[model samples]
Target: MRCLENRVPPPLLMVIIGLAMAPAITPQLPYAAPWQWLLCALLVLAGGVVVSLALRAFVQHKTTVNPLQPARATSLVSSGIFARSRNPMYLAMVCFLTAWAVLGGWQWQWLGPMLFAAYIQRFQIAPEERAMLQLFGRDYQEYTAAVPRWWRWRTK
Candidate 1:
């Protein structure tokens, strides 16, 4: 159980789940070519920016970005993309999935992002938060109190 917490990297899990959900995403709606491409491109660019900002913050702080090694983190980043979402890296992945779903015109593919979020929240973010609590104590507590796990635009 706990041993499986950080075993599978989130990106890998998302890919596996997305593939499994592919069949359901078929019979996709026909959408305007330009509009679909525009939406997909926007999502991918947003995701790239979000992920890059998160990675830059981690590098700046000299913290480990490896999800499998939260204990190796040397600092807690609560700025930049992190301020908007406690798990910006995960959010970036969700954004990419959203783009995929949209491009495929598969309403069922929308489930990929939702499922990814749920899985990360349960198995990845939860354990990482616990480790952060242990490592940073009050600072991490304050951060959790302030920043929502997914996005600040959403309710706590």
Candidate 2:
């Protein structure tokens, strides 16, 4: 399982999971209407914006955005969208998968997003956080204490 850490990209994993879940969901679910499609489009757009904001923050901080190498990050970004979620990229992928599920009108499609979150938490975010804790030390610790693993309006 350790070998799976950061090996498969989150976006690819989302797509694969989304595709795999769709067939099981679609046949058993109702068809989406125009309003649902519109909502799905909005969700995809929002997801894209979330990812873009995170990437821009990384670029501005001159930190490595590469998911495979958390040790290579030059800085700990805690401003902008990073202040809201430690893993906006992963959150964005979750949003995208959710939107895809909505587009298909899959009543049981919540599993796709749930599975993605579970996989990311175990294989991706956990390893990345460990690496960040090692690389950034106290600063990253404080940031984690302030921000969340995923988006939340208030700290808990």
Could you estimate the TM-score for every candidate? 0.88, 0.89
Question: Alpha-carbon error at 99 in model 2, in Å?
Answer: 0.5
Candidate 2 clashing pairs, residues 3+ apart or interchain: none
Model 1 vs. true fold: TM: 0.88
Best by TM-score: 2
Across residues 19-42, which tens digit of lDDT does each residue of candidate 1 receive? Answer: 776665544535437887799799
Q: Write one digit per residue (lDDT tens) for candidate 2, span 1-156.
A: 899998988878988998888786666445667887788799899899999999999999999988988889888888899989999999889888888777765467788899999999999999999999998899999998888899879645
Clashes of each: 0, 0
lDDT of 1 at 93: 92
| CA RMSD of all predictions | 2.8, 2.4
Which runs of model 2 end up more than 4 angstroms from their true locations?
24-30, 154-156
Question: Which of the numbered candidates is closest to the native, going by highest lDDT?
Answer: 2
